[model samples]
Target: TYIRHDSKDQFTGLLDKNGVEIYEGDIVKDADSGSYGAVVWSNDKHWGYLFDTRPDYGWSHPVKGFQRNYLEVTGNIHETLLEADNAKT
Candidate 1:
């Protein structure tokens, strides 16, 4: 039996502001600005980097093109899970 998983993986052939390989599942963060979000793409608007950590946020904004070079990879969603577990102990 072929083990199948979520097929949400896709390469945008792009890199983050900090030279990090911005993959589909990467959770990007702006340390200096205290902002973060997952990377995704859309046919029209392209998730515009930094998915924002708020729902229906009023002041949420996308990472500017110039700011992309300043982004740092804190961790992806998978790694975040491990972090949460480690923090519990």
Candidate 2:
């Protein structure tokens, strides 16, 4: 089966602590803070990748500088949300 172009996410040109490529829609965990968030593109003036924790913690940070060092990809939003939904059912 063919997948829609929009269904695919863009790579952020960065890697997780485990050396996995970081991509939009990926759910990453902050080793220092032990918090999780999904990767998303920012539309603000900074205009780059953002580690969005708004859904769970009401805060976010740009995925630049030293922040990428502690990020580890635990899962993607699709599978993460699915697992959450299943847990609620």
- Best by TM-score, which number? 2
The lDDT of model 1 is 0.58
Clashing residue pairs in candidate 2 (N, C-alpha, C atoms within 3 angstroms): none
Error of 2 at 47 (Å): 7.4
**Residue 18 lDDT (model 1):** 57
Compose the digit string of candidate 1's lDDT tens values, residues 14-67. Answer: 567656656665676766666777765533455445465454652334555666
TM-score against truth, every candidate = 0.54, 0.68
Clashing pairs in 1: 17-68, 17-69
Cα lDDT of model 2 overall? 0.69
How does residue 31 of candidate 2 score in lDDT?
A: 91
Q: Quick one: how many clashes does candidate 2 have?
A: 0
Query: Given candidate 1, what's the lDDT at residue 4?
Result: 22
- Per-residue lDDT of model 2, residues 1-89, tens digit only: 11121358777788877778787888778898887877777655331334555556444477775777898887777776777999999
